[model samples]
Target: MESSPLSALEQRLISHLQVLYPQTDAGELARQCLSALKLDAKTPSPQPHRNIWDQRDIMLITYGDTLRWDDHPPLETLHGFVKTRLSDAISVVHLLPFFPYSSDDGFSVMDYTTVNPSVGRWRHVSALAQDFKVMGDLVINHCSSRSRWFENYKAGVEPGASYFYEADPNADLSNVVRPRTSPLLREIQTQNGIKHVWCTFSHDQIDLNFENPAVLLEFLSIIYQYLEQGIRWFRLDAVAFLWKTPGTSCINLPNTHEIIRLLRLLIEHKAEDAVIITETNIPNRENLTYFGNANEAHLIYNFSLPPLLINTLVTGSCDHLKNWLMRMPPAQQGTTYLDFVASHDGVGLRPTEGLLTEWELDNLINTMKRFGGKVSSRTLPSGDIKPYEINISLWNALSGSVAKGPDQWQFARFMCAAGIQLALEGVPALYIHSLFGTENDHDRVEHTGQLRSINRHIWNMDDLEHALNTPTHHQKVFEAMVRLLKIRRGQPAFHPNATQYVLHMGDRLFAFWRQSLDRRQSLFAIFNISDEPQSFNLAELNLIATDEWTDLVSGQKHEDLLGKVTLMPYQFLWLANKVGKLSEPN
Candidate 1:
């Protein structure tokens, strides 16, 4: 028999494991983890991991149970809908944690290995994978207390007994950055005795002890199992809190980044193209650290974009957004952002920390309240609570209630948000609620008594399809968005790797220019975020006076490019000199 191959991947895995789990057999555990990858040996796969994104990389973010079916599992229904409705328009489906959970929707995971019985089985995921790439959330920060591991710990089980952190109730943990106002420690009656375990998010979600090598190995096994099931895109949910060291902020700790880097390394060897997208909802500077010289995360959530975008549209000023964009680090060769306006949660306000002033941020909170949005707060080290996230659907949050204004007002503003999101220099991910043009789910919020329920609407797949196809508001945005994405994907200039130049288009207008990697295709995208009219000389944005331009959105020709073009409230334009050539046949 041939000797087991000793490759650099195995060496690196052993090194990481040795550091994290020195007491355990690092070499043996690394070998075990690598052995768990179930690649098909019958055929030579070309691309095991396709991490780099492109203009075609638009995604729909939805819970696996977002769409329901009484007769079959919801994942089956979701898979069918993606095939029928979204196969062409969107290329990826980010199915938020379909795993069994005890609380926090799907964030408090009960089992990492199996799909929730309520959602379909692994077969359903594989079915969808055949059509479009599916991005699965790996909630690595914490697990449900009701999980077997937690139960085992309560029963004095070997590895489980040492899997979680237990701290003294009186310990001073004031320096920790908390996402919620909940108490950090929870008293649990374990087999050893009654103890206070460090439960970061909630009492039910017990924080795992990454200091224990067994925990890291267990997660590695779980991740390898996911890779086996063809999940190339793994979204590390709440990754900033992955590793905890006492007497510190415990957010974005170096050990946490190291853990992420190990996972990325696993992907590099086992699944070459697998993407690790980190979700850090903290302020911008600390969040950007996940890039880690291109070895940590292939993508980090652009958390600042949602609030900043809303701020731009609400204030009719691009100063904040423009300043933020201009100062943003250019996308590295291997990494980019998963840019989004809203998600299953809400518009996070914490990300606006350094970007907006106290007054500007307060303006947003007040505006959200005026729009019937709810705010959730986080605890500070000073023991004061501050607003952290605004809970409401992106539609209601943006244009307020449709009942309050003309349909044009609502539609224009909604499309403008989408336009700016797409115009950003990253892959755009739209929440399902946004795509369906749904408003706040006040009924669900009252029924479930969960603030996030305001945005998390459950729908019957067939009903949503029929409802969104008609001339309803949902259908209007859906149709327009589809057209926009279809056009966006066909243009080479919109590639995520393209170089972007923030252009000066006065105060009310947001403009940017994108040039393709080969310099063959160039497109300038501009958005009018204000209610009032705004005009600018096309030449000001660098469209030469002699160059013939085409407005992709309107299909209008601009031969006299230097002339002024006035934008109506919330109008967006995509101008390209060689539209005929750049507009590829889809």
Candidate 2:
């Protein structure tokens, strides 16, 4: 009898295994990987979505328990809220880590296969997925020390005896790149005597050893469970630090990229429509590598967008923002960027490393402090501490400008930031708090003693509904955001992979031109990033004299291609030659 030939997927898996675990039997591990994918003869055939995504696909990022009422589980409450209020505007809902955890607000996951009892059961998650696409965090880098796997390791069990990365406390870890000020090696007493395990984010979050092929199989099974529960989008949380190596920077190591490629392969094979987004909060250049020739990371968090956009709004200059935008390579066919101005965590400063100068960064940091933002620091290789992120509410962060103190243009400024975000060439994700214009929650911060708590406001559903029904700024911002998102949904020019060109209209004004893929629609998104009035000739845009143009936001017609248009302080316009109406969700 002759040996059978390896399938294409098997060949690819073996290649990845060779790269990640060279000492192991690659062929045997490949078979084990295939088994983990549950790709049996009875497996369902892949049914990919007609379009992986389009202009109408807007993702709303929120915690499972962000909104609470009575004794109802937060997931149920969140489902009711979305169905009643946001179903028309948001096509996708990203629930940030709803798993049982020991600390770090769910990022330190204790269980990968089940829902947190406090949040609700997996049925509640499936309920939301019935109406909207659901996205979940895969917390791939580390797990809570309280997890059963860690306990098994402590007991010297077979499955998890060597499941975590260990290093000598005195090793030359000086070159290790991590985003925490805590000690990297945690000394623990195991059944096999003393051991020092690596803790990248926090002592409670123990790093898993991917060098062990068994750990990879465990996560593959977890991914299968998530797919069965109606989750097609996976956010690989803190993935940049996934692979560890001694005598190296230990961040974005080659093994990390190989693992991502392997995961992408298995995921796409399991569910053709499945999307994998890598949460790599690194510098711009390093961040771009996650794309991996369109084979890895169907989407990446536009990590540099928050700090750079906020800086532009506060400093009233678009030089840095424009420069960064121009250098960004447009995402290819199978991949795009997830753009946002704010998220669950703080505005990461690491992504802005080479993009912004030291003086510019310091000025931005000072402005954030003036706006009541807290700075979180990280330990450098030389034991020096430097600011890593700015923790503050998006509403508060845009309260005023660096040139002037707190002003009366807070609402306008916030809207301007959001408007620019929506018009960019990517899928726009709005945090739940940003929708309601929530301010910094000092009470929460004081209660939790965590800097990031300032932005994670837990709202009472009753209070949120009441505020939306009233005429408060919360109501105003919520209604405005919905309207903007609705408008974006119908425009082909706003597709995540549409054509984009940075336009030069001076430093105080940021402008971009977006054209539909089929070349039918052209939109000029211009914003006055200052606290004063600004005007420019429409002729500079070179609008076609034959076709009529209209401002999508105000519905005002522009008869003369050479006419002048004035934008008030913190104002923006979505001018287009061809108009698209607000589309209803399918």
Candidate 3:
């Protein structure tokens, strides 16, 4: 068989997959997948490719309160804010679901072409896209049942419509599985009344019929319109469920992968600078598929990460996280992974859910219930319930309320989470809220209760500014995040293409080292995830050179050959080797 001329990342992906699934013809399958996409081959190629996204490329998540702030803040004020606070470290800003939509936090698209009036007009969005590196949501997996596309399709509006997926009139929903575990689904009646529309999420969000060539073309046109308007990044939402067939869960389907590859080719041809990011919130194993051949999605969300962060904290161990990283398939050198601790949505329990044994899960559930009817754990168990329960009991005894008090400890915990993520080999995306230590928005519970509750709250600039300027505990956490961002941006070892190796540090701490292929520069990161201090011997690593290295955060330099290094509770260190002469300080 002739070898394929795939990109570096694609080759790495294929090699990793071959090891996992030995019998499958990974390369041939990838080629076939690329060939089946709906893209035009004539599109131009992107230029000025970037290896990693910077801390200045912070993705500020905006919704109700944030949008309101944007409306009130003078353009110059917003611009100045970005320039001063984030310009050097941030490169991109992602606005969440600004399109016209009906439900599920604006996932239901009433119109792909227009922005929701509640946030701003399409022109305002276009202006922002022109002024800044912006990315918008492309919810092609489904549409608002109220949208003209769905309405026209339901009314049988010939070629002008027919853009939705229509099931057999009498198809059963009894066995249909929803994203959530619930069995109740909202069904829409077509004009014939005999045929009903299947909504995977809610009645308002009707699944789009990607099987139709016309539908694909329509969406392609929609994408071009945005590209022309200066939207460089298209976050493909819920792509996993785009294609459905009987006997399958309709996720990560072969056709869906093909569609993504085709779209990548088209984007490359049309808007060369534009990129597609898939919002596949699956396990690490399945998430790699979205980055097909390194040519499909330019970026994939580290969906399993947030839970891993939480698990590491509660377990006081990095075993699960290390295992997950070891299992991650390598991608193209230039390609970047989007790592984050949280986002506009709630924390997902799915990724780490299966990692826990049934007994462990039940114990966690019971602990949450007993503590305050909510899941809460500071670290994972070393042996079993006795040690785990003792840790939680100690936490409860020392801390008055998990929700409040001991703010520094909470901030440290959050920092520990951020440290591991920023050190990982990927483009770290810090959710604006998380940076400022915004906890669960319990007040928005009612809004999230509604079909599209996630989009209900407005952005409060005053509140955000206040939090940023104040001396609150959350503010401290934000400062720590900023420090790490600044450090990561200054170090080349943190680049996306740098080689990564996970170190086994006795479970309590997760340590990793990133070095240039030529060994010109190197960075070693150690994170103490547990509440107690932990020490590890550096001699075991046998790093090429351990001479005098500077602690990026503390400005302290060590030149000792000591075999031991101790990390304080929830502390982290970013040590870079200082060779020859240190250039004039920035």
Candidate 4:
């Protein structure tokens, strides 16, 4: 007798699981996993139903200094801000690392179930989650060494207390080099004196022992609790390092993927709308795998975005941007990439390294050093320097703070970035500060003395008042972002997993189009990244519209004009044809 097709797929899946977890009940687990997948297929995936992510669907990320909720303003105050200011364009909110932690901008979780008092209480968080209909961080990858789990392991408390991944008691610390160069190490003492636990990035952030089923169950329970409170999304922090082996780099291991797949399957089965977003801050190549054929994370952060923004800014070219876009595979049937410019953490150099040549990196370093004031000398091996001034300037530029420059130039850069994010085949994530063109908070850095100190400041009503009345740089940036968001919300082509590609324009410009299969509606986004004005022939667009179309940005209307269109310096236009026409295939 031959096995059925369903049983055959189940058998193959069980065999795959056996290779990773040899001791587990593979057959039973496979049956459960299949059932879960079937259940998920019956339920609707938690995503926006429309083609474009509405401006109101934007996710405003707030961390450290920007945690205005910490001041205990009435919950209605925050709700009103979201409702009135971004009601049309913004939909979700991401509060970064509100859990208690030791260092590295709250990556070290002391307690998974509780929110840090500095931000708010669990009750407040629960209330906010209910009000906003959003979810937040689930730092299951690592925990602070001071956490109760770690302490219980150290004290040898009963009921699987010794489950933590501990270093060999006889291992020599003198020979063991620390993973990071920071001086924040705190050695844990076992029965046989001190033993060095692995703290991959920070000494205080002790990696959890995922090899233990207890740890896995504990995290699952926590997730279920948050789901009860209305958390529809969970950002799995530092997921790459969750599983480890002695010989390998211990990142992106097979077990890690399996665990993520299992967790995703379980969550989708239990709660229909909840999603798991993997925070694998790796290169594009490595980050792609986190999606796991759309079975792992529902979304992964597009780490390549920041560097692309910087590259376009410096070289005034869209070649690298085009290459990156062309290289990205379409999001698997249901999943989407969470794209953004600046995040709550520091701008990473890993993704940009492959995109930039040695000479380009050197030029970038020199430029940063020249512009960077107090923080200019800090350099990386790739020749990129963390010039504080350049960082602040770029932040200001994006936020619309520095307004005296050519409006076309500033607006061009702003619109170009926004176009890429919105037109891309994914959910575009907007950082809260980016909306208002918020600059680096130097005051917060002085207070926290951490690399991401600026991320911690909270928004004050007084500051908003001042910016609105005084017409500061941030005010203009904020207004521009709001306008772009409003326009994007009204469009239909900017939906998740839409077919997109970079247009073959000159190096100084970037262009892409998103269209439906029937060609009833379409969006064309062209950006001029260069400081000097650049032009492109509209004939190259080969759009199928016989009627005139209007430019959303300049409010200018023109006919196809024999297949020719020209763009101004740093300008971007979203031209749409209401006649249900498609562009001629390239």
* Number of the top TM-score candidate: 2
How high is the CA lDDT of each candidate model? 0.82, 0.92, 0.62, 0.64
Candidate with the larger lDDT of 1 and 3: 1
User: What ranges in model 1 sit over 4 Å off?
Assistant: 1-6, 22-25, 36-51, 400-408, 544-547, 580-586
User: Which candidate ranks first by lDDT, i.e. highest?
Assistant: 2
Q: For candidate 3, write residues 223-338 as lDDT tens digits.
A: 77777677888899988878877555667887788777767656665555676889886656677778776767888988877656665675566787888887776557546788
- RMSD (CA, angstroms), candidate 1: 3.2
TM-score quality measure for candidate 2: 0.98
Q: Write the per-residue lDDT of candidate 2 for residues 1-586, one digit (tens) a residue.
A: 9978877677777899998888999998888887887764234434432249999999999999999999999999999988888877989999999999998889999898889999999999998999999999999989999999999999999667888999998889999988999999999999999999999999999999998889999999899899999999999999999999899999999889999999988888888888999999899999999999888899999999999999999989999999999999999887899998999999999999998989999999999999999999999989999999999999999999998968999999999999999999888999999999999999999999899999999999899989999999999999999998889999999999999999999998999999998999999999999999999999999898888899999899999888889999999999999999787864
User: Model 4, range 528-576, lDDT digits (tens) per residue?
Assistant: 7766667666677776656567776667776754545556656777876
Candidate 4 Cα outliers beyond 4 Å, as residue runs: 1-20, 24-56, 64-77, 158-160, 168-180, 183-186, 369-412, 563-566, 579-586
10 residues in a row with least lDDT, candidate 4: 577-586
TM-score of each: 0.94, 0.98, 0.81, 0.83
Better of 1 and 4 by TM-score: 1
Going through the candidates in the order shown, the clash numbers are 3, 0, 30, 24
